[model samples]
Target: MFTFLMMLLLFVPIGITVDLAEKVGKMLENDVPFGEIAFYYLDFTVYFANLLFPLFLFLSVIWFTSKLANNTEIVAFLSSGVSFSRFLRPYMIGASIVAGFALFLGMYLAPIASQGFNEFKFKYLKKNKSVQQTKDVYQQINDHDYIYVSNFIPKTKSGLNFTYEHFEGNELKYKIFADRISYVEKDSAYKLTTYLKRSFDNGIETVEKETQKTVQFPFELEDLTPVEYAAETKSYGELLDFIAAEKRRGSPNIGRYEVVKLKKWSLPVSIFILTIIAVAVSSIKRRGGMGVNLAFGIAIAMIYVFFDKVFGVMAEQSNFPAIVAVWFPNVIFGILAIYLLQNAKR
Candidate 1:
């Protein structure tokens, strides 16, 4: 526990420092206050630190436990007739406890903190002001109707030269065109502001609608809640619900969000897997004292991290299913852990 706490405190501050320096450097380019950037960095780094806690836990357990073994304590224990597998029971128990807490934090608390941190960043330090290169944007406000924007600016909640279509299955119902569109937040409901509208019947026929005001009615704007903004929301129930809702509306972004949701649960399992591997690798003492074993453990952990990023990118980009992509690295390492464990037991 002392080792775990020490590593946690040390690494978290290092993470915070690195993030703050990066944020401050970026803010300097925009002439924003270094303190403001530092705050944002701190917020994000806290969330990141929590996510990395499992790695720290695994490292501490291996480092300290291996040092104990190297000092002849494990030798004495073995001489006392304790089987090697039996000797691992306590360490396994501790690993299981850490795994449980890791799951809890990943699936529940982390998402809330992620939401808060993202919101703070968006409000204060967002570098981009507009949506980039959208070929088509579609939204269905009600039954049998949808709106499409060729280009959109999320900063202004506005789209340029938009078109709205109404359809009943395969039949063309009605359509509308606007020079520009925007959304305004109000106490009760959101207002969609459009400069002009041209109504169409039978797909091709168009009729102009004269309006005194610039805004349009019956258009639903997006919810501004953090739950709406964050893809990192915890709670399997909530994620499932959100995925169902988005799928019904035919949203593409929902796929990646679901991927992240599933990954949260899978990531905690790496703690257990790494624990097994570390124990296996560190059991046999080498001439370099504990340092060689420690170096191998860290190297293996780094390889796992690299594998993780590779798969994460594949999940994001290629046609590979995100669920499969995210879990592939874990699957590989789990096999490696099992092999190492068996070999070490001999």
Candidate 2:
């Protein structure tokens, strides 16, 4: 409960500061209402809550454990025939709870909140929003087929430098290049209209007859949607489908999504491991004191982050299994925690 209050306290002000600073900067040259700026600030801050949560959990653990050690409660438990592992059981439980909360917020609440925040930015912050918008741009229209728009305006569903490619296995089958493409709203649906098409056949190029609508392909142009911003934006159910769909398509960036999905579970597990490790590291009353405990804890945390990031990058570029890549750091540290627990008990 106390930890939650601390998180709330830190989250609100930081959010406001960020929002107001941007608003003030924007307003110095333009006239925007104070109330609107305040609303934007609130929205910005709320969206950042997820990013702030991990630090909150880490600091809370450190502060709480430091107090426990300062009071010699942890030392007394170890001296009373209580194994360090047994003593750390509650800390593990607490970490699990925090991790659960983090997962819930990250997977569910954050996505919904992010939509509002992004909309606010697009509507208020962006100038010429249509020209700047980019979503549903370059998309895989079908297997072995791709559509790319050099720039797309999502609001108008218009694109410039449109290029479409069809591939047979690894060989290029047909390529169509267009100067511009636009979507026409028909009744309740939309139709894509192209202004130009250059088709390549038998290693020869010909300008296909230009028309607003043409059945020149095996796949429909409208079938593609933008790649999702990130897995975190999708619900847990959506994330599963997204990953499966991408994997089936032989998408390269799926490693990032895989890591994200695993992270939902792994983040919770990490809390438990770190709690055990912290208890083991701090169980002995060291001459260097809680400062030593903190330094060691921070060092371990930094090493964990470093390796996690490195593996994440490697996984992106290589054929490293996403599940293994994401969880390897945790597994290594978990073993370290167990070993330290045994040593500390003696």
Candidate 3:
């Protein structure tokens, strides 16, 4: 725990400093207030902490165990008739504690921090790039109503080539079409341009057309336009409901959201996997002392991170199953941990 805290202290500030340096110009250009800037940094600290959590645990374990090996403590302990399995008990307990904390962060705290962090980023650093906009969206507002938009823009609360269909018992009751549809805040209603409404009743059709019209709809802009990183900013329960709703809406970002959802659980499991690997690799005494163990552990950590990012990208950018992308690193490292533990037993 002490080593973990030390690693956290060492790395978080460095991350904050590097980020501040890069974003300082943007903050100044946007004329952001001092308080908001400070709050953004705090959010960024949480974001980075959650991001580098596994690396932090991995390195801390390597450092602590390597020092013990360098000082001959590991040899002394083993020579005193403590089996390797017995020696691993305390490390497992420590890993459980860290894993619980990481789980809490992923499930709850990280979402709040992510919201603040991403909000500040898109608000200041990358203006006019709202995540709530998408192209060619189709959604079922209810069993009886459907809507589509060729392009939806949240900033203006408007859409192009908007179409709405009302159905009753597998029959189209009416359909509405508009060249443009927009929400009017003052009136709490929708304004449609080049509007046309067609109703069908017992094979008799009635058509109503207008250049412009004001009307009410059963849905709101928020229902149609979800933020791209909405998954990251939602609690576990909320994310599950959100994912279900998105699935109902035929959202194209299912893979990306699934990856985020799975990682919340997978990260805690990874803590145990990494801890075992660290102890196994560092428990053996070497002529080069702790240096060799530290180097080897760092390399493994980097490779783990590389695999995680590559697989995560594949899941986000393609139809690859998110479960595989999220769990593959843990499986590979779990195997490594087993192999190293067996060798250390000798």
Which pairs of residues clash in candidate 2, taking residues 3 or more apart in a chain or in different chains?
A: 136-226
Clashes of 1: 0
- Provide TM-scores for the models: 0.82, 0.72, 0.95
Give the better candidate number (1 or 3) by lDDT. 3
lDDT of each residue in 1-346, candidate 1, tens digit only: 6787798888888877776666665556667666655655565765786667668877887798789778878778878998888988877787778778777777777777677677666555675632233436665555676767777666666666677776778676666666666665554332334434454555576655643235444554452111334467456678777677656555546546767777777777877888788788887767887888888888988988898778777765556688887788789999998999898777
- Candidate 1 has an lDDT of 0.69
lDDT for 125 in candidate 3 is: 92
> Candidate 2's residue-wise lDDT over 83-188, tens digit each?
7657767666777677778788777876676666665565667644442226435556557887776776665666677777878887786677666666655533
Ranking by TM-score: 3, 1, 2
* Model 2: CA > 4 A from native: 1-24, 27-48, 51-54, 121-138, 142-157, 160-177, 185-208, 211-230, 246-252, 313-321
Global CA lDDT computed for model 3: 0.91
Better of 2 and 3 by TM-score: 3
Listed per candidate, the RMSD to the true structure in angstroms reads 3.9, 5.1, 1.6
In candidate 1 the C-alpha lDDT for residue 169 amounts to 81
